[model samples]
Structures are given as C-alpha cells and as structure tokens.
Target: MDPTDTAVMIENYEAFRSEISLSKEDVIRELFRQNQDRISIKKEATAVRNLIRIIDSTLRLANSKGFHAMTLRDLCADSGLSMGGLYAYIRNKDDLIHLIQNHGFIITRRTLLHYTRDVPDVRDRLYAAIKAHLYLSELMRAWFYFSYMEAKSLPPQEKRDAVAIEREIEAIFLGVIEAGIDAGVYQPRNARLVSSMIKALLQDWYLKRRKYLDQNVPVDDYAMFVRDVVESYLLQA
Candidate 1:
C-alpha cells in the first residue's frame, strides 16, 4: 500500500467533483430543510425549490455587491421573492450571512470527509484530500470567495467558527501526514506545520485563482503539481 512511488489513478479534480455531484436544488433543500425554527421557509417541494433560488440569488448579489451593501430589497428583487418570502428564510442581513456561511461549511466539510475517509494509503489519502478541496472550491468558487473576503464582517462568534472550520480542514491534512510518518512512508517532519503549509497553498487556489487562471492553469494541473511537490517533500531522504 506504499503509494509513495507506485503508479495509481491520480485523476483530475473533476473525478472528485463527480463523486459528490449535487444539483443546486438539492443543496438548498439539504441546507434549509432542517431549520424549521430558525428559518420559516415551508417544507413543501415548491417551497424547497424556491429556497434554492433564494440562496443562489442572495449569494450572487452578495458576491457582486459587498454583503454589507446588499439590502433586503435587492435580495428580494434578485431572488424573485418578496420581502415576506425572504423574511421566511432570514430575519435580516446578519441572519442571511449566517445561513449562507453555515450551509457552505456543512457541504464543504461533509464532502471533504466523505471523499477522503476511505483512502487506504496515506499518500493516496493526501492526494484525495487536496483534490477534493481544490475541486470543491472550484465548483463552489463563489461561496469560497465570499467566505474569505467577507469573513471579517461576521460577528465575533461566527468569525471564530469560520477560523475553526479552516483549522478543521488543516487537521485533516495533518492527520494524513502524521499517518504517513507513522507508517515510515514519509520522512519525519512537523506534521501540523507541514499541513498548514499545504492548507495555505490550497487556500491560494481559491483566493487568488484569477492569477493562476490567467496563466491558464487547470485544476487537474494544479492538483497534480501540488501532489508532486508535497509527495516529493515528504519522501525526501
């Protein structure tokens, strides 16, 4: 099970993306269907469908205009939902941001854990983690973009939660590196520190994608490059 040098199917991010293929409607329903108390949105099929429209529109508008600059009226107009309907989803702008952030975290965290949970080898696990994260960020670029840029605007507790989420992701990478070290597949190093570096590189993929995209770097290319560099560093004598 030593994936340190042997050939294996290191497919593109698209392969990871396909494993968690979810439609827009499904995301909305899955996010809001549980918050009956917090969100007044009805649970009917059409209502759940419209909730997706509302979330999609809110994110779009919030991304275009700063979340602070986006008003309830703008959300209503963009989402094609009246104030009453919008209120059912969120009480105010703060609530709106909370809803969006929570939903994004749930999906991102779940996807990462699911795809990386079964990797038998630490090297393969690391590769899958990197590819899953990069592809998820690519597929939900707007969510990642909004979360990063607008994070400071969130309330103190919410901001803490955001940081915690980031650390949790880093911990996943840390676990894989530690496991590799334990199995003598990777050279010893500070696993946590190394994981943080890996997380930083992965974050840059979503944060400064324009720079990479300008150079015509594709996700698969970036994923493989990351895998190569990380594996090379880990396997050093």
Candidate 2:
C-alpha cells in the first residue's frame, strides 16, 4: 500500500479490527496475567473467563448507575457470579476500579501503538492512530464512558495514573504530528495544541456517542470526518 496516498491510505473499521485483537477475551487474558498475583484465581482459563464477566458487568453497571453507587452485591448479581466468585477476581470496589482503569488503558495504549508504530508515512500513521482510537472506543464504548465518568471519584494515586494514561496517549499523537512537521508533510504549527485537539475529537466520539448515534452516524464515517478536521490544519497549501 502507498502510504502517502490519502485516498489509498484511508482504512475502515473492519480493516482496523482484523489488524488488531481487542476482543473482551483478549483484553481480559492480558489483564489476568498482569494481575495474577492479586487475582486469587489460580487457573488462567477460569480467571480470564470470570474477569471478562466481572469487567463487562462493571462497565455496564458503572455506565448505567455510576461506579460509586455500584456495589459488589450488584456486581455479583449483574455478572451472575456469587459473592465468593467475585472476590476471587476483585477484593473491593476500589480494586475493581483499578482493574477497569488499567485494562482499558492497556487496550487503548496497545491499539494506538500497534496501528501507528511501524507505519512510515506520517499522515497515514496519524489516520491509523485516529481510526484505531475511534474504532476501539466504539467497540468498548461502555468502558470508555465508565472511565471518563468515574475518573473524578478515583483515589489520589489512581487518579494520577489516569491522567498519566491520557498524556501518554496524547504524546503518541504529538510524536506523529511532530514527525510530519519535520518531514514537511504537515505545516509548521503548535504540534502540542494540535495533538490535544485531536484527543478531544477522539474523546467526543465515546463521551458524546448518544448524540452521534442519535443521528445514526457510523464510526467509519466519524473516523474519516475526524481525519478531515485534523488534516485540514495539518496539511500545507
């Protein structure tokens, strides 16, 4: 594929999906591995399956009724796991919050890096980064919404961790824009500001999805629209 050709470079959600594995099982497996010491479940397969249920139910409950208001009892009922079974995965609500936050961050960080890291053409890389975010958010809309909504209630350290995650993702975009400017593919401008704007645009899709869904706008279309808005300021005349 000619990376420089915008027409050819554009990719849809299906292409992004095939290239990246962000399934619930895939993410939960990684999550279980990362938190094995903390997760009392000894068996990988059982732990991963239960983690999926716990995480999915958490996102659903958190998005619907607010994370702070959600109880472990509610989680157990919602996920169809006994209280003892839920404890095998998470000790407390705070622990559950951390699990949710970390898993979402891990997936988001990995998705952006996977799509953009090896692409040589900066513009194509930027589009890939943008599309990766929008598509991933669309897939995990509840997680994204839950993370944003519950961030304020996070403990001091976890809140800082959440902020760091946002900056790290933004830095990925900044790196691409700076590369484009250095290569003269994009105009000389405030790359940092541009990156922040890009993040806000991407966040809007998940945060305000009701509005977009109300209009029946598809994610692929939203991806192209974001690329257009971003590239308009990026590309030189």
Candidate 3:
C-alpha cells in the first residue's frame, strides 16, 4: 500500500470487533467436536457444559501456575471436574497444551481474516489488522496470555506448529503491507520486517496487559497508538 495513497485514522473497532463472529461456547464445543475421536471417553463426555468447564479450568490454571507445572489433579480441582472427567477430554498435559493452542489459533485467525477481508483500503486494512488483533487478544485474554507465556513449553511438534501459527498471524499483516506496496500506496520497505515489528507491538498488549490495565488503558486506545506508530513509520520516506 502506498502510505501516501491512504491516510486514515481508525475510529471504530466494531468493524473489526464483533460479538457474533465466534462465541466462547462455540469454541468449547468445537474443541470437543473435533477431538472427540481422539478422546476415548467421548461417548459419555459429550456435554458441552462439562467440556467448557474443563477448558475454562485448564486455561485458568495454566495462566496462574504455568502450563508446564500445572497437574491434572490441579486442573480437576480448579475446574471442579474429577480427574476421570479430565482424562476424558485430554490424555495428558501436552494434549491440553495443544487444545488451548487450538482454541487460540481458531479464534484469532478466523477473526483476523474475517474483519480484514472486507476492507479495501490498505490503510484501513492495516489499521483493521492492528485493531482486530488487539481486540481479539483482549477478548481472548486467558488463551492469548497463556499461549504467549507457554508457547515454548509445548512438546516438540506442537511447539513447532505453535511457532508457525504465530508466523501465519504475522503474515496477515505482511500481506497487507505487500498489498500496499504493490498498489504504490505505502512507502517501500522490507514488508516482512515491518510486519514482524507490528506483531511485536501488538503482542505487548497481552504480554504487558497488567501494565496497561494498571494505567487504565483500554484496548482501543492501545490499538490506536500502535496503528498510528505503524502507519507513520510506513508512511515515512
């Protein structure tokens, strides 16, 4: 995008943030639905409510006490599910890790693509990308926080896929930058590097959320800050 061809401030997050795009209950149900074949106790464990209970408990525990250190017993206790019930959904911690990662990827990738696809202006698309990511992270705080904090704790193959998930995420932004460049709207630069930089800035929202929360900074405010900084940098000659 030619930075000069498009210069717009993003004032509305509704275009990027939607309540109906995906729901928590749907996410929980999807997890159980997709992995039911792998789950041995699937027949008796088809309750969406119970499945959600397990997922909620797992993420809460993982966020509080590191995904690596949290035990099945601990998850059961926090989630109010018996160890037997827990085993029905997951074979072990690694499976739990993959499950949470799955939730994060499904919601984030879908939301990002859904919101940005309709935006024609590279500036708006870039702006929507930044805001969409931040809002999604804000909405999926537990999963996003847990995913960022414990990505390395994942087992070998899951860890690699996790990293690739992050890259694909950044590629969403990279695609926008390349689009801008192709259209002669954005000033030329290393689009990949710029995309990574944007990812870094957006990641700070969830990584350092407490700092922003302590200062009473809202998601929209931070999104605007990052969007402005990124647009200015890209617009620079």
Candidate 4:
C-alpha cells in the first residue's frame, strides 16, 4: 500500500498511539486498581511501581520459559521480590494467570471501544477498530504472546475465560462490520466470518512478529494493508 493511500489510516493510528499508553507502568497501575482487594499493598504509587516490575518480570520469565515451567521462585528472583511479597499480590500461579489475562482483556476492550464507538462513518469506525487492535497488540506484544501461548494450560475456568476474551474481541469487530452493512456503507457479506478473519490477520502480526520483523514489515504498513484488503472486500464498486 502506498503511504499516501493510508494517510488517514496513519493519522488514526498515530492518534490512537498518542492518546493511549500501553506502557507497563500504566497497565500495572490499572491492574493494581482492579485487584486492590486481592493485593495486600495499600500505597497506590508503591504498588503500581512494584506491580510494573512484577508483571514485566513475569512476562519476560514466562515468555523465555513456558508459563507452566516457571515457578514462583523464578518470578521472585526475576522480579526482585520476596516469595512473601509475591504472595501478597497473588495466591498462586492460577491467580497470576487470571490477573494477566484480565489485565490484557480489560485494556483491549477499553481501547477498541474508545477508538471505534461514536464515529459516525461506519467505514472509518471499522478501520479505526482494526488499526486500534493492531496498534495495541504491537505495543503489548509480550503480553499478547504470553496470553496466546499459555491459554491452553490454564486451569479449566481460566481457560474458558481466555476463550471468552478472544470471542469478545472478535465480536467487537463483528459489530463494526455488521453496522457497516446495515448502514449500507459496505456490501452484504458474512460479518462474523469476516471479523474472525480480521482477527486472524491481526494475530499474524503479533504471533508471528519475528517473521514479519525479519521480512521488514512495519506495523503501520501492515495495518494499512489489512485495512485495504478488508475494505476492498466489503466496499461496493
């Protein structure tokens, strides 16, 4: 795709990038807020800072090794926290898994809705959702990688929750496409399948990131390509 062809896409993507932060500290701060009752820490600032260390270290350790193979001791050593301190935030690996999954899901849902909702043009809204997801995944690649790789080994309920999160994200795209069709902005098509396909394309960016990186694919370029392909399929000639 030509850079000029995606000028609006680049603009929306840059807007999303500037307006939202997926920094570890910001994510952990929100995580701390949601899990304050479970976490023993009382000081927000201190908890946020340490939670950043703990979560970042967890992602690093889990991705380097597997989440199942990683131990609390490993986490403690990696995070520079005592076993007792780790326990203050999580009761066990199960708790930690839930925290990590919920943290990503919460931010993802929020980010998608923030970028897409209230946009009057259905085409722009769909493109916004696509770019927003791609941009956020690029920002939180480690968390995205860990979440996908570790979902199967999660305890049964956690596994179910993970599937639900994936479906909800797919549903967000489905909603946008369905709205576009209803609004007559796009030709009639299978919105659900299209949404799932868009998700698979998005996953290709994050899950096979090394392949793309080695191939010299920038995320913005990939995002515009996806938007172009999806629009070509959906738009009336």
Which candidate achieves the best lDDT against the true structure? 2
What's the C-alpha lDDT at position 232 in model 1? 85
lDDT of each: 0.80, 0.84, 0.77, 0.82
Q: What TM-score, over all chains together, does every model reach?
A: 0.90, 0.91, 0.87, 0.89
lDDT for each residue of candidate 2 in 1-237, tens digit (9 for 90 to 100): 122223233368777666455355776788888888888889999998888888889888888887878899999999999998898888888889889898898888867776677788888899888987888888888988888887888988779999999999999999999999999999999999999999899899998888998999999989889989999988857
Model 4, global lDDT? 0.82
Better of 1 and 2 by TM-score: 2
In model 4, residue pairs whose N, Cα or C atoms come closer than 3 Å (at least 3 residues apart or on different chains), thus clashing, are: none
lDDT of 4 by residue, 52-92 (tens): 78778889998899888899999999999999888888999
lDDT (tens digit, per residue) of candidate 1 on 113-147: 76677678788899888887888889888889899
Between 1 and 2, whose lDDT is larger? Answer: 2
Ranking by lDDT: 2, 4, 1, 3
Is candidate 2 or 4 superior in lDDT? 2
Q: Which ten residues in a row have the lowest lDDT in candidate 1?
A: 1-10
Off-target runs (Cα >4 Å) in candidate 3 are 1-22, 41-45
lDDT of 3 by residue, 163-217 (tens): 8889898999999999999998889989999999999988888889889989998
Clashing pairs in 2: none
lDDT of 3 at 125: 90
